[model samples]
Target: MLPSAIVSMTEFPLNSNGKIDRKALPAPEFTMERCDKVAYVAPQSPAHITTCEILASLLGVDKVGLDDNFFVLGGHSILAMKAIMAIKQAIGIDINIVNLFEAQSVRELCVLVDAELLRKQLEETEEFEEEGVF
Candidate 1:
């Protein structure tokens, strides 16, 4: 969705001989749209909140706020690579590193983490059953 707040310059004042004037006018500026309405959004999800807390405390951000954007909070590819390694060591699951950037928001990242966790659990259970260990 395009932001409607941005405005473009219309025209530059012309000099007496129909030449463009550079010094006679003030600096041109783009107008920004102002909106007075505030909208309500749902509360932060449990998993997302948890991830936010972890990322904030570990990555050194302001605080563990779920609404915070990962990149805006100062996360990058190197951090994401480190995150994947940490996640695998902590959760015992292999996850693709690219998912971190694609799933930019904490909520989306939580979903991917949950899915990977469940997949690993199921695989372990299946392995146990295959060995007839119940």
Candidate 2:
């Protein structure tokens, strides 16, 4: 059966042994008032599109919006790393993990990616000039 609701915990409850306390976990509230669907927002730019695609593929979702938050969509550190690696391999840009966490949305991530790409290009240009290649 499909899940009825999604619960978000700020932090996992811990037992005296420092392990996750399953018994202390809050019960899931089965409420019909919750909406499971997210309104889709189309990506605006190439960077936005690429980020959205990467996030959707990593998260196993059919579609992802530019404004959709990664963590809110069930993304974790491992998934984040996978997503970043995929983005790097696909677009040749390395997005910092801290920046990804700070900017959780695809739109925000695209901006960061663009800046990083530009910075890399500028650095390469400087190095080439120093070598008298340009």
Candidate 3:
């Protein structure tokens, strides 16, 4: 796991017994900051837009771009699971958690979801043909 922020201090606060005071350290602030490493790219497709919305809502951000990294947007494992569930509920498709970690972007995730949807459609078509329904 990566730290959200780093705190700089001149000296450590100590207790009466000479032990470092844990409570004296300032709490790390976890805020949503736009990723600077990559330029902002707006979502272009419906699937990309929906995936962006799910990630943005979960991370408490205003907008998510196509190339935004989920972890860099303050998303962790728990939020990743919620994202998976939200995508399944909203898109009617199941995605593995590992895929989210591997993809880490709205564009990548939408591609995975789209592939899964197409695979399901193909399976249904094959089943229908086998059953002589069409």
Candidate 4:
């Protein structure tokens, strides 16, 4: 498993007995360092914006950008399930957890969601044609 945070120090804090002081260690700072790899891209479409909001809420972050990585944002398997469920509830489209693992970005997920929406629309249109509703 990847470490949640890493701290670099010149020397370890020691107790009177010369043992390392665990409590004296500084708290690990959690930063969005992973996001530095990619330029921050704002969400342009409604679907993208909504997806970012859901992820940000789930991850307890203030904001989520289109290119933000889910795992880097502290999402795990359990959280992945929650995210998929949340998306289904919010957008009315089911997303496979496997796709989340493969994509892991709001922009990529919106692409999948858009494709599923189009597919559902096509299915409804076909059913209407069959029933001569059009």
Best by lDDT: 3
If scored against the real structure, what TM-score would every candidate get?
0.58, 0.68, 0.88, 0.79
Predictions ranked by TM-score, top down? 3, 4, 2, 1
Per-residue alpha-carbon lDDT of model 2 for 36-59, expressed as tens digits? Answer: 355678987787788888898887
Error (Å) of candidate 3 at residue 122 is 1.1
Backbone collisions counted per model:
0, 0, 0, 0
Runs of candidate 4 exceeding 4 Å displacement: 8-26
- Report the lDDT tens digits of candidate 4 across residue range 16-131: 99999999999997676765777778888777788888888999988888888888878888888999999889888888899998885767888998898888899999999999
Q: In model 4, where is the ten-residue run with the lowest total lDDT?
A: 30-39
| Residue lDDT tens for model 3, 5-62 | 9878888999889999998877876544546667779988777788899999998988
Question: Model 1 has how many clashing residue pairs?
Answer: 0
Ranking by lDDT: 3, 4, 2, 1
Residue 94 alpha-carbon offset, candidate 1, angstroms = 2.2
Best by TM-score: 3
User: What would you estimate as the lDDT of candidate 1?
Assistant: 0.62
lDDT of each: 0.62, 0.81, 0.86, 0.85
C-alpha lDDT of candidate 2 relative to the true structure: 0.81
Model 1: weakest 10-residue lDDT segment is: 32-41
